[model samples]
Target: MKKRWYDYLWIASALYLILGFFNILFAWLGLLCFFLPLIISITTGSKAYCNRYCGRGQLFALLGGRFGLSRQHDIPRWMKSKWFRCGFLLFFLVMFGQMLVNTALVFSGARDLGQAVTLLWTFKLPWHWAYHGGVSPWIAQFAFGFYSVMLTSTVLGLVTMALFKPRSWCVYCPMGTMTQLICRAEYRPERKKTAC
Candidate 1:
């Protein structure tokens, strides 16, 4: 098969992680990853982003498929269950909500900027070296929190890739789930009103 331009997105995905590690502000770029999928799904009523344009998915395929890092085991039935996927989506949204709340607090001067990246929503890894003090507290706080979310999800994808198939993380990815939902809603049949 001929490789398309998007096939090289894995390099861009890897670079984003590397750049964000060295410059915390680069984390803001993650918003594109978060929004582009939904926009594509809504406009096209399809999951083209999740199926084709997802850089992280491509990265996992490169690592687990080309590099042979995956065990190639089937993902557990529970992990593929709709209930589990929805639950995970709910949990991910709650974490995102918390991140937004923290950013709002910093913006309001109610809380100081947090300089650490919270991994798995528990471990606070110091990331002060990546952050400079020139930016607004809220902006920097958002960067740190958003970076944590992106890094944590990437770690989960890597782990699942190693344990199961390379694209196993896609089964329950929150963005994938959201985009699926958006596509479904976009194409859902509507009841036509009867004229009086």
Candidate 2:
């Protein structure tokens, strides 16, 4: 198969991680990754973002498929079930909600700006060096929280990639699930009409 221009997005995915590591402010760009998929799914009523345009998915495929990092085993049956996918999506949304609340607290001066990245919502790793004190506290807080979410998802993807087949993470990815839901909702009435 011929490669499309989007395939090269894996490079951008890798660069985004590197940039966030060095300068956390760049973490705000992660919003593009979070939003563009839903926007595409909503507008097109397809999972085109997950199917062809997700840079992180492409990066996983490159690492696990080309670099042979994956064990190439099948993902667990339970993990592929709808219940697990929906549950994972729910958990991911809860974490995202907490991040928003934290940012809101900072914005309202109810809490101090956080300078650490919470990995997996558990380990608070000091990330202060990446932050410079010029911006508003809430803006920087959002960057930290958003970067944590991005990094945590990448770590999970890498772990799953190493344990199972390349792109296995796509099976239960929260964004993928959300986009799938969006696509289903968009087409549900059409399907009903055709059936009737």
Candidate 3:
């Protein structure tokens, strides 16, 4: 079968899911798998994942294409300004803090710390049951909420891309932001040609 551009999203998502499972089961191999997509995306472009291989992206493309909402528009510069960048950075920092705190709580025997955090965020899923039932309730809730946030963010990204010409989600994506910082240090833009 000729692979469509959208098929890549599904492939990537599947890879991510498998990697997550392996990370939980095999650990070391999972760590390597985690970086695989990141390396591929950086070497190629955000399209390596968002445009091609993300399951969420594939779903979005299908729905948008069917509904005639697939049109892309130019993202305004102001929307990508310093304020937005700072805000996104702050958001990432908060997420990191939450993750650190959750880990600390799990290790320190303050078991319910993680679940309280999830409940505060309105995520009521039973994480332990979803997993192997060995992890504490707090850790389980944290994992559930973490995955929920990831899924929510992906949907939001799709909506942003469908409405914006240049893939708006890339602008505020934490991973993309980090990769771009690395790429900028190594990449130089080609000079424009001018007619004599």
Candidate 4:
């Protein structure tokens, strides 16, 4: 498939990962990018963010297709089942809540903000633990939790590409689940209006 100009949005995820190493402020700021698209999805009943702007989704597409890393297989039925998608969504919600709490504590002057601000993949490894010295323990836990998600997604995306389609990960992505909910909510009213 031909790559569109918008496919460059995948770089945002890399940028976010990079920003994570510098300052929590920059990472938090990047959240605005998410919220804006979320709002648009709710209003338009479209997963515009996932399809057009999500960095992770874009990266998955790149690794699976353009990069020629995928095996070009078809996605399994079980993987696309609603149950699997909802489960992933629930898992993400819980983890994201935890990260939010720890980040909030850092913002509230309860933790060393400077220490809390650091890269995503570092500080968790034995050698890099020193990088997080003086930072709140819970904050690192939160960061690690997020990094786990990123790592899991990237790995799964690659695996799916090897076994199934390149975009197959999107079928089970938590972001896609959330966007489906948002778009479905907006869709219900129109269906009701037409039925009436």
TM-score for each model: 0.94, 0.94, 0.59, 0.69
Better of 2 and 4 by lDDT: 2
What's the true lDDT of residue 64 in model 4? 73
Model 1: lDDT to the true structure: 0.93
Residues 165-192 of candidate 4: C-alpha lDDT, one tens digit per residue: 7778788877778878888776755344
Please provide, for model 1 over 49-133, each residue's C-alpha lDDT reduced to its tens digit, 9 standing for 90 to 100. Answer: 9878899999999999999999999999999888999999999999999999999999999999989999989999999999977
Lowest lDDT sum, 10 consecutive residues, model 3, at 22-31
**Candidate 1 wrong stretches, greater than 4 Å:** 188-196
Model 4: runs farther than 4 Å from truth?
Answer: 1-5, 21-25, 104-148, 188-196
Query: Per-residue lDDT for 193 in model 1?
Result: 84
lDDT at 196, model 1: 95
Number of colliding residue pairs in each model? 0, 0, 6, 2
lDDT (C-alpha, whole model) for all candidates: 0.93, 0.93, 0.54, 0.65
For residue 191, give model 2's deviation from the true position in Å.
9.0
Full-model lDDT, candidate 4: 0.65
Between candidates 3 and 4, name the one with more favorable lDDT: 4
Better of 1 and 3 by lDDT: 1
Better of 1 and 3 by TM-score: 1
| Candidate 3 Cα errors over 4 Å, as ranges | 1-6, 11-34, 37-59, 66-76, 113-132, 135-142, 158-167, 189-196
- Candidate 2, residues 1-196, lDDT tens digits: the string is 9989998999999999999888899999999988999899988899988888889999999999999999999999999999999999999999999999999999999999989999988999999999978899999999999999999999999999999999998999999999998988888553445554
